[model samples]
Target: MALVFRPDKKSIEKTLAALKSYGNLVAPDARFNYDAKDGLRKEVCFRDEDFLSLLSSIDDEYVVDSILEMLKGKALVPPDAFYSKDAFDKLVALTKEKWYYPWTSFTKAMRRLFYMLASIKQPRIVVGMGIFYGYTLAWSAGPSCGKDKLYNAERVYGVDINTEAIEGARKNFAILEGSDHVELIAEDGRLVAQRLEGPVVFLHLDADGEKIGKKLYLELLKILYPKLAKGAWVLAHDVTDPGFQKQGVFTEYLNYVRDPKYFSESILFDIDQCGLELSIK
Candidate 1:
């Protein structure tokens, strides 16, 4: 249930030949990359362009469209689904206007992917773990709880370990157009998830742990595994391919999602070095 994006092949061609070609690329026997975070955190080689080199060698919109096509093929979204350009622009601009934090790691493609998943899935309850400034929360919650909401959401909760960051994110979310359903909680992600009763429609993970960092994803997933409703979507940020990932952090996490015993299917959006993984329950 995993996918791969190849630079030589241009896009993820989902044909039989393409899948066969990507076999070696995604083989489990591949060596792990410990410094996978280095390339992601480094600056642009060229001065004036995107500091993160958001689109280093590929077209941004094209990558998004290709991923959407893959999702459509999997029947996760409509045949002709497309996230609105104006809506996405407004969401980004508004968040930038009121943002209190100095950093948000999500690049443009990653942000769009989160928004697309939310809008398409139309999840009723969206939970974000390790939400720093609610930037990730806003992207996923935009379609249902923000100023540019396409539909209303019942509840959207953001859990963060940093009390001061949560306070800043609270102020940022306070300015959303129709974000009454959104709440920022200053608590550990696992604890907040443990408190959830049931039927959490959507979950976003981007937390950093003291020892494991992103590996806490597996623990959070196990906690909410029973509460997730049918067709629920779980997104883990930074679940990139082997070379662009930290060692030992996501091995068990990815295995859980790829297992049919848990998620029905999982796809890795490797458009960015800092990738996103989507799993359906």
Candidate 2:
């Protein structure tokens, strides 16, 4: 990730030290405008070439267009990549409700991408970390209609640390049509990951992005690595958010996935700061 901060030697040194603690190497890059006080601010690039390449590869023109159409023109055209009618219908229905938390609702473009990928992957088990009102859980569950169902996944498991949020999600699930396939658990994500036994075909990470977030994410990865099925798809939220980027969350995450052992193909959907990684194990 690219970072531009005020040209303070002490601040730069502190930032570099923090980044190195997360297994990142700092490299000097071209300066850019950061604020009015600083005419031109210094820039630094994290040495995560593989992760950056993966982010570039998955950013498609069609995805960008779809995001613009949804947010700008308020158009709801499903991307051509999403061919499942049932999945599309579910996405539309979920968006109509105001059940999700204001901060946690999935954007239309992100939902569309998830529907498309889930339809294609047809994972046997769908796992969601940090469930907030179950909006993403519904999407990961895929279409519930027997005739319209195209995925092989039988159930979706949602884990969240907040008991109140878990209760809210359960209430939302109760009112949702064809939501019988969802299971909500109020527990730490790390424990949930440890208990999960079967192959995970689809995984979504949407938890916090600081110390707790980094710990839970990495711990879950260690547990899930052996359990991931071939063609498993993983989506991580907020990788490009300004707050996360400032906190070095994105850099630490990129370093983890950049290892050759984890994923075969990975991409960062620039829209809504969603990052996706694919594994063929």
Candidate 3:
């Protein structure tokens, strides 16, 4: 019966105790806070907005990791302050693919994707190839496993082809609990590489077409190769969607499938029988 996004630990504890009085808190922290004023000086506060603002200050790479822990239902515990890269990756993947609950499942997918990227060595940047309303909304939810972790990403960017989608993404982040961790760009996803100035920890090509997705992926590799961290994570969503197959998007873009340079890795999920993960290792 815990509330949502409790910023400060002390306040969160008090809130949790109070929420237990209610019928298994589903969203008590929906709007809770803790503030103290001394003379003419006001100190810290613990509101959902404040919690989100705190998340905004986080580094992009770590943000995903932090949120993964939070959604796992671990961040609520008193902190012993531990950070393990391997532990993080395993935990993230487990939480996402293993956790229950419809909303929590979405958060887990995002966490799995984000943690995979964050774990890459010395990544300098991360990008969301395209932002759509449903996708962004799905990405914004917290972790489904650990609770102690908080967001800590370094540099992040979100790109999109639709202006309205971009705007919706912006508004979504504006109201979400921890949106300050990302940057949103309402532009064509194909040009993300040209626009970015650093190595990529992760890249997601979620545009609605195979041609554009392929072009963007190749362009990103060409422009950002030097900056690409070894073993970095790259994600392509809806790669096997009916529309893509119907239009032969994958066949058109992958006409000459490259060898060893890239390989496919699949992620199995119980939610969707068609769910398959594609990656190069």
What are the RMSD figures for all models against the true structure?
11.1, 9.1, 18.9
Candidate 2 structure quality by residue, lDDT tens digits, 136-212? 76666655423466654577888888888899888877766566778899988888888788788788887653467
lDDT of 3 by residue, 1-281 (tens): 98776257777777676765653222544433335442232433332334333443443345545544553463322244333455555454543454322231123334444443343322345676655642432232222112423444566677777777777666655543344556777766546667676656565555553455444555554565555565554555544443444455555334322334553332322112112233443
Better of 1 and 3 by TM-score: 1
Evaluate residue 144 in candidate 2 and report its C-alpha lDDT on the 0 to 100 scale.
Answer: 47
TM-score, per-candidate, Cα-based: 0.78, 0.67, 0.47
Provide the global lDDT of candidate 1 against the true structure. 0.78
Model 3, which residues run further than 4 Å from truth? Answer: 1-124, 137-151, 209-222, 252-258, 262-276
lDDT of each: 0.78, 0.63, 0.46
Q: What tens digits encode model 1's per-residue C-alpha lDDT throughout 1-281?
A: 89975344234233435545555333333323434583463333322134335572346667777788988997878897777767887888887776777787787788887887787888889999999878888888888855456888899989999999899888988887788889889998889888887799899988888777778889999999899999899999887634425255687898989999888889887666567888999
Query: Which pairs of residues collide in model 2?
Result: none
In model 3, the worst 10-residue window by lDDT is 267-276
Instruction: Kindly give the stretch of ten consecutive residues in candidate 1 with the minimal lDDT sum.
Output: 43-52
Better of 2 and 3 by TM-score: 2
Highest TM-score model number: 1
